[model samples]
Target: MRALLTTGTPPTWTVTEIAPPAVAPDQVLVEVTTAGLNRADLLMREGAYVPSSADWNVGPDRVGFEMAGRVRAVGDRVTGIAPGQYVMAQTGGACAELVAVDHRLLLPVPDPQDLVAAAGLPSALLTEYDALTGAARFRPGDRVLITGGAGGVGHIGVQLARALGARTVIATTRSQDKAGLLRELGATRVIDTASEDIATALGPDAFDVCLDHLGGPVLAGLLGAAAPRARIVQIGRLAGTHAHLDLETLAARRIQLIGTTFRGRDTDELHALNARVREALPGLLRTHDVRPVVDSVLDLSEAERAGQLLDRPGLTGKVILRIVA
Candidate 1:
């Protein structure tokens, strides 16, 4: 089997022959068809985000976060799934020809859809869903603001918020070109954070929910733009994690500031999120609405290129790795 090996260095990815992963009694063996690259993948390569397990390979680690594939074998205890079943899963070490995944994290691929596009959905969509519904508790007619609005999670977040009946969806992008694209994707208003001030564009106490993908000054500004009793869900820190917050302002307006990350979810929690996404998948995919935003697809051998591309500025969506059989 061939896999992308990250040697704990930038501008380098080695495709090496590695043994296939053995399926544990509680895991299923998947023949990966495509794998999705995420911002976390880049951080992990730079020795920033380490996996929970020490034994897990770090440098020269097999890298990949989300994948769309077919079940080649199922564990003894795994039920309701079998060989030849097409599925998408969230797992580490997915940049390989094979992956041993917990059955709970596997979701049936939607019908009449491209598997390549499906590859980009698991991590971004699940994170957005969790941030909006699970953490933020957004309701219909709510005015929601999403920072980093044109990035992978932000674009999807915009669509999901709209689909869930958010009355006014406001998205912020540092790139000027993406503002129009964000509006086309269901955002009622798009603010270019590079020049325009979010606080001024949206008057004080304007938004019911604020989804912050970019932290630092941008997040601070968002806090000032929140409506009374609003929810501020911080899902990413692309611009730097450290940010100043006015506790008095937050308390005075009854605002909730939540900082969240999905990398540490246990199998049970991952399964629960998967189930909720599964229920919502049919409607979202059937309408060809809220599709995964894929910026580019590279061959598996080009994993390094994908990583570099993700680091580039002005990226509007996900970068997927097309794994050849």
Candidate 2:
């Protein structure tokens, strides 16, 4: 099997031959068709985000969080899914020809014909869904705010909020060119962070819920503007991890601040979370309401190029690595 392997600090990755993973009774073996490139992959490569599971350290295939593939084999206990079925899953060691994923975690590709785009859906969708519904406890008719709205998770977050019946959805982006795209996706208002400040643009006490991806100083300012008793779910820290919170403001407004990640969860918890997403995803996809954005698709062997594209500033949507076909 050929996989993208990472080497050294500020790591560089390349396609190399590696042993295929073995299947456990609760797992299904998949012939990977495509894998999604995430910021976590880039961070992991650069030795910033370490894998939370030991399986990721088992071999040269150091990092793969999400993939779309065809089920090639199923363990004895695995049911409902069999060989030749198209599916997507969240699992480590997915940047390879074959990967073994827990049967419970496998998701039916909403659009079976376009597995390439489907590959990019798992991480972004699962992460955002959990943040909005699980952590933030978002309700229909709530006013929502999504930071870094042009990025992978951010774009999808916009659409999901709207599909969930959010009364108002506001998103922030550094590029004005993306304002139209963000609005088309579901955002009622798009803020160009380059010129206007987010807190001022949205106005204080404007949003009922905020799905924050870009943390740091910006988050602190945004917190001050959240509606009373509003919920803010912190999904990613692309801007910077550290943020100073105003305890007084939070207490005065009764705002809830939550931090969430899939990496920290156990397998059972992940499976449960994915199950919730799986239930909601098909409906949204069927209606063409929430679509996963794919910036580009590169061949699996061009792993280094994919990494480079992801690293480039102002890149929007998910970068996919085509493993087969």
Candidate 3:
């Protein structure tokens, strides 16, 4: 099996042979076809991770988070999964030819023909799904706001909010060139952060809920934009974590600023959350209403190029690395 290794602290792609993962009775062995590149992958390359993840050394077996593949085999305890089913999943490591993951996390691809795009869906899907549908307590007909709308999770967040029946969906991006695409995707309004101030452009108390990924200065803007009692789910800190917020406004409006991540969750908690996503996904996917934005597809041999693509400023959508294909 060939897998990509991370040269610690300023990582570079280095592929080498590695043993396939051992399968547990409750897991499935997948023949990885494509894997998605995430910001987390870049952070890992820089030797950054949760302190507990020290054992997750920079190596071939520790580089990927999400992948799409065909089921090569299922463990004895895994029910309803059979060989040859096209699926996608987020596992501890997935940049290799084969990966073993819990059967419950496997998502059956709605369109097997689009498996390459499916490789990028799991992480963003789970992140925004949980943030909007769970943490933000999204309601149909509510006015929604999605910050950083051109990125992988942000673009999909825009579509999902619309799919869930939001009366208005506002998306933000640093690039004006992407505003048209964001509107095409589902945004009722697209804010070009490059030229407009998010707070002033959006006006006050207009949005009922917000799924915010860029949590620096944007956080302050989202606070003013949210309606009374609005829920703002902070899911990412791409724009730096520090922010200067107005405590008076938050208290007066009864706005609930919530934070979320799967980082500290246990297996049972993740499985439960994923189950909810799994239930709603098939219907949404069938409609072709919400899908991953794939920026580029490169062979696994071009992992370094994929890394460069991932870092391109204002890059929209996931960079996929084809594994078996």
Candidate 4:
């Protein structure tokens, strides 16, 4: 078995042979077909992101966070799911050819034969579902705003906001090249932050709910733009962690600002979150109304090139790592 490793202080990933993972009674073994490269994978390389569990601290003490594949073996306690079933899961060490995953984290692949697309769905689906519906507590007819709207999780956030019946869905991006794609995915408006003023573009008291992944100045602008009693959920800080909040505006609006991260969650909590996201995914996929926007697909061995691609600006979707069988 070969797993990707990030070795050194600055970090560089390379495939290295390793012993296969052993399954526990509550776990299943998956023969990985494809793995989605999340921003977290890029952050982990720089010693910036940490996995939820130490079990992932393998070679150079890092691992892949999400994957889609076929079940190769099942634990005695696992039922209803069988070997050969195509599945996607949120688990550590997913960059490897095989991974031992808890059954509760499993979601059936929407298209068993299309592993490349399935590979890009898990992380975005789980993260945004929890952020929008669970943390943000989205409601129909509400005006929703999403920062980094063309990103891996942001694009999904756009679709979910519309599917749930938002009156208006506003997204922020660095450029307008992705505006049409975002609109097709359900975004009612796309704000090019590089050229447009977000607060001016959307106006005062416009959004009922806001999901922000870019912090810093972007977050400050959102704080001032939020409607009264709006719910603002922070899922990422890609723009920089520190931000000066508009305290006066926040107080005037009675806004609820929340910060969410899987890093602080326990395994059981994540398993439950994954289960909930899994339940809602099939309906979206079946209708062909929501699907992952794949930016590029690379062979498993091209880990370095994949990382470089993710670092580029104006990326529109997920980068998938396909393991050739």
TM-score of each: 0.94, 0.96, 0.95, 0.96
Deviating ranges (above 4 Å) for candidate 4: 53-60
lDDT of 4 by residue, 1-325 (tens): 8888787766788888888888899888999999988888887787777675533534435457888999999998999889989998777778889989888888888888888888888888888889988999888899999999999999989988888789999998988898899889998888989898888887789899999989888898887678999999988988889999879898998999998987757777877787787778777777646788999999888989998888888578989888647
Q: Global CA lDDT of candidate 4, please?
A: 0.85
Candidate 3 per-residue lDDT over residues 1-325, each given as its tens digit: 8888776445677787878878889989999999998888887777665422211222433678889999999998999999999999877667889988888788877678987899999888888888998899998999999999889888889988989899999999888889889988899999888899887997788898998899988898777777899999998898879999998989999999999876667777778777898999977787746888889999988998888899999589899999997
RMSD of each: 2.3, 1.6, 2.2, 1.6
Clashes of each: 1, 0, 0, 0
Q: Which pairs clash in model 3? A: none
Better of 2 and 3 by lDDT: 2
Model 4 lDDT-worst window of ten: 53-62
Off by over 4 Å in 3: 51-61
Clashing pairs in 2: none
Model 3 local distance difference test score: 0.84
In order, the Cα lDDT scores of the candidates are: 0.83, 0.85, 0.84, 0.85
